[model samples]
Target: MQVKEEKEFTIQKRRCLVVWVYSLKQLKTLKRYGLIHYVSRRMKYVVIYMNEEDIEQSEEKINGLHFVRKVERSYRPDVEMNFAEKIGTKAAYQYKEEEGFEVEEISTQIRLAENV
Candidate 1:
């Protein structure tokens, strides 16, 4: 005579995209498209956080941009590291440093979405 309750998963699976752009001019375009989590001035790259599905939908368009160098998919291997850990890999950091930015003080601006 007992009823079982079902649990719901309201959280969506989101992934971080490390997008490399040749120039800051493309920032306007990216801003217009939305979904950017943090923009790093050091490497001329921005970290975009979005539901995996949404990224899949726009991947082609973003990758097609001549200004965009690459879009790296950063994922979590375990819960220990923070969100930015993926991009903090040695190779990635080296690339940023070679670009002339102080790796330790890589500047980033966080963007908040009012309507996510």
Candidate 2:
């Protein structure tokens, strides 16, 4: 009997680069740096996803381009994404209802004052 070997698939960690540009025409040049994830026409920015290992070099090269106004690294990777610990905690559900007058009561009070 022949044994079948299973191959492991690995996903590379990618980080987003937010590049603000003067014009969208030079997008071809930006493609060489990383995978273009999103391009915002209205805001004039491009979101590029690059492998974590190559991000530093790509960031410098992308920033040196003439059309690029600024390049900012996305902080998504650094942020805490785990909410499992806090999900069932008492503190998480203990939000106090804001003490404010109800709209119906306020309207009734206003009507009574007008009639007086």
Candidate 3:
């Protein structure tokens, strides 16, 4: 008789795209609650939204026991683009002047998760 091997999923950390109206207070909450960290190898963009802060906080609390990695900040362009793509058709767009600056506006708000 042959035995079947069970595959295991190693989920140490999770990525969350938080959406908010932009506020320093919310950002602080995310950091204070340990809901945010630095995803160095995978990314380099810092995303700390308001709505997901609560959920991320809870996740941190739970995962703390297992010493699992929590949320992290990324500031890399590639990561930012990937994040935008993951958000579906939301993100935003930018318009640049022929010889000046650039302007950006939100195309839509598509929060994949209600909480996080």
Candidate 4:
């Protein structure tokens, strides 16, 4: 009996590109660059996810499009996401009350009007 070997699946590293366009009509042309993750119709921006290796080339191509206003790379991958060390630390959770602020009190008593 021959044993079948299972192939190992690997996750590809990807980066997000925030592309701002003058109009949404050119969305079909932008689809060739990367996978569209999100589109903000009101804000006129599109979020695209592409393999990290191809990000630079994709950014340049997308920027050349006349409809595109600007292309920005997402910094999420570079930012540290670990909060384990900060979690439960006093400084991390400390709330400081503002000083020198006073609240004026208003009397709540309502006086009934006497008949004229």
* Window of ten residues with lowest summed lDDT in model 2: 100-109
State, as a TM-score between 0 and 1, how close model 2 is to the true structure.
0.68
lDDT by residue (1-116, candidate 1, tens digit) is 99999999798877777889998777878764447888888779988777777877666778888999998877663356564666766556455445585447778877779744
Q: Residue 43, candidate 2: how far off, in angstroms?
A: 1.4
Candidate 3 per-residue lDDT over residues 1-116, each given as its tens digit: 99999999964444454222222333444464444533332333334423333555654553443333343333342354455567654534544457566569869867777655
TM-score of each: 0.53, 0.68, 0.21, 0.69
lDDT of 3 at 2: 100
Instruction: Please give the lDDT score for candidate 1.
Output: 0.76
Regions more than 4 Å wrong, model 1: 1-9, 32-34, 77-116
lDDT of each: 0.76, 0.90, 0.43, 0.90
**TM-score rank order:** 4, 2, 1, 3
lDDT per residue for candidate 4 within 38-76, as digits (tens), equals 999999999999999999888988989899999999999
Model 4 score (lDDT): 0.90
- Give the Å error, residue 64, model 1: 0.3
Q: Estimate the TM-score for candidate 1.
A: 0.53
